[model samples]
Target: MSLAVGAVSSSKNMGFDESKDSEEKSHVSESSKNLPPPSPTPTEEALREGEKYNRQMSETSLYATEEEEDDEERKIELGPQCTLKEQLEKDKDDESLRRWKEQLLGSVDLNSVGETLEPDVKILSLSILSPDRPELLLRIPEAGNPKGLWFTLKEGSRYSLKFSFKVSNNIVSGLKYTNTVWKTGVKVDSTKEMLGTFSPQAEPYTHEMPEETTPSGIFARGSYSAKTKFVDDDNQSYLSINYTFDIKKDWPSTS
Candidate 1:
C-alpha cells in the first residue's frame, strides 16, 4: 500500500497541477497587495463638468467687472456743467478783466447806459502777462466814453476789490456820455477768480469777482473808466472802455 501511494504522488499530473495552482494563487495575492492606487480617469462627463464650472466662474467675474465699469461711466457722464460762476469759483486767483460772457448770455443794461441799450458783447482777444502773478489784456470795443467814469471798489475787510458804476442819459441825468467801463480785477495773486453770477435762481446777470489775493504789492495802480453816449431816458446808448496797464514789475523770465 505504501509503495502504491508513493507512486501516485510522484505522478506528473498531480504534482505539476498542484504546483501551478499554488503559484497562481500566490502571485494573485502578492500582486493584489502591492498594486498601485487607481488612476484618475479623464471621463467625458467629468471633463464636461469641470469645463462648465470654469466657464461659469469666468463669466461671473467678467460680468461683475463690467457692471463696475458701467457705473463709473455713468458717474462721469452726469457731472456739473462749466458755467462762468464755476470757472470763477475754481480759478479764484485769475484777475485779467471784467468778462461780459455772463451778461451777454441774456440782454441787460450794461453800465446803465442810455435807454435800455443791449449791445452785443463778446469776449475778444485775451492776453495774460505777469511777473509773480498773471495780468490780463482785454480788448472791449463797444463800451461808450470811458474817461471820468470812476469805478468804486466795494469797501470791506475782505481782500477783494470791486468796481461798479452806472451810465444814464446825458440829457436826462446831466451825466457825461461815459461809454466804456474799466476796472482792475481782484489782485493778480489772488487764489480766487471772479464769479459771474451768484444767484442761480435768477437769470445770469452780472458777474462778481471773488477775493483771493497774495500780498505781493503788485497792486493795480492804473486809471480805468468807461466812455459813453446816451440817446434818451429809455432808449439807446453806446459805450467804449479804456484802462491803463500799470504794474511795477519786470516781465516774467519763463511762463
Candidate 2:
C-alpha cells in the first residue's frame, strides 16, 4: 500500500510540471510576436545604395543639360555677324555717294549771280561831276533840253561820281561800287571789282566817287548808259542807279 501511494504522488507532480512549462512557452511566443524585425542582409543594403546613386546622377545630368541649353539660347539672341566683304561693299557705296554730290555742285553758274536787296537802305541820287569845270554840274538830260545839252566828256577825262543814300535803321559796315556801261539797251562793258570799304555809318550818307578816266579812242564815241551798284556791309546789294552820258572826241569851243 505504501509503495503504490508514493508512485501516484510522483505521477501527479510530473503532470503539474509539464502544464507549467507549456503555459510559459505560450507567453514567450506572444512576446516574440511584438518584437522588432531582423537586420537586412548585405545584398539588400547594396541594392539600396545603388538606387540612391543612380537618382543623384540623373539629377546632375539634368542640371548640366539645362546649362548647355541656356548657353545656346544666348548665342542665338546675338545679332548676325558682319563679314569683311559686306563691310567693304558699304564703304564703296559711301564713296560713290560723296563723288556724286561733288559733281552736282560743280555745275553752278557764278558770273550771272545776283543777290537779293535789303530794303532798309536806298540810294537818293547819283550824278557825275567835273572838278575842272565846277559849274558843270552835269544832270540827267531831258528830251526838251538843247540838242547839245547832254553830258559830253572827252576820252581820258577825269570825273567824280556823287551818290547820296539813306538808311532806315541799320548801319552800313561796308560799301561796294560796280560800274557797268550799256549801249542801245545792251551791256557793253562792266567793272565787277569792289571799289572800297567804308566805316560803319547811319542813314543819310554821301559817298563821293573816286576820280576815274573815261575810255579813249574811236570805239568810245557813242551813246552810253552808266550803272552803279551799292552793296551794304553784309555783302548784299541795296541800291543801283543808271545815268545816260555821251563820250566826245573834243570839248565844244567856248565862245
Candidate 3:
C-alpha cells in the first residue's frame, strides 16, 4: 500500500483509454490481524523507555490493523502518542536531523503543527477507468456526498479505481480503504486495501487499485448501493461515503 509513491498525471475528469478494453476490479483485500504491541508510530513516536525500548520493531505488523467494528480484539497502544511539533523539536542542532525533518514535514505551517495530534486525511476525487470507453470521475464534497446516485459502469467491463487525497496534521500509518457493494440487500463485493504509511507533505497522494471487471448479462445491469471509508491504524476514520450507481449493458452516452 502507500501506493501514492508515484505522482499520477492530473486531469479534471477520468480519462478513457480509447484503446483495447482491459482491467478488472481493483481491491487490496485485508485479512483481519491482531495489532501486537506497538512499533514506533513513525516520526510521531510514542510510549515508555522500558518494555517499549525492548519491544521488537516488527511488533507493528506489516499488515494494516483491521477495523475495530468487525474485530473483537481491543487496541493496546501504538505507543505513547505525541504531536507533530513534539517530534520535530527533539533534535534541533544536527544539520542532518534538520534536513530530514524538513523532508518529512514538507511545507507544513509551523504554527499549526500543534493544532492536531492525529493525522488528517482528505479524500478528494475518485477515478473510474474502463478501457475504450469514457471514464468517470466522482468529486467528493468536503462533507461527503453519501446520498442518491453517483455514477454508472458498463456491465462486464474491465475497470480500475483510483483515488487522490491530501494528508495533514501528522503522519498516517496503516491507512486503509474499504468498500462494500450491495445489490437488492445482498452483499456482492467487498474490498479492503491497506495503503501503507505516509508522511505529511504539501502535495496530495494518488493511489490506484487493481483492475476489476463487472458481472455481465441481464442480471448484472442494475442499480447498486455502496459504502466507502478511509481509516487509519489507530481506528481514526477520516471520511465515509455512501452512494449508488447503475451498470448498463453498454456505456452511457458521453455526448
Off by over 4 Å in 2: 1-119, 135-150, 183-188, 192-203, 233-236, 251-255
Error of 1 at 129 (Å): 25
Question: Which candidate number has the best TM-score?
Answer: 3
Pairs of colliding residues, candidate 2? none
Candidate order (TM-score): 3, 2, 1
Highest lDDT scorer = 3
Cα lDDT tens digits for candidate 3, 144-185: 565577887888889999898888888898898989999998
Off by over 4 Å in 3: 1-76, 91-109
Model 1 regions more than 4 Å off = 1-142, 152-202, 213-240, 244-255
**How well does each candidate superpose onto the true structure, as a TM-score?**
0.18, 0.39, 0.65
lDDT of 1 at 92: 42
Q: Ten consecutive residues with minimal summed lDDT in candidate 2? A: 108-117
Q: Report the C-alpha lDDT of model 1 over 5-112, residue by residue, as the tens digit.
A: 888778765556777879999999999988898898899999999999999999887743323733543453323334333333454454433244334233323233
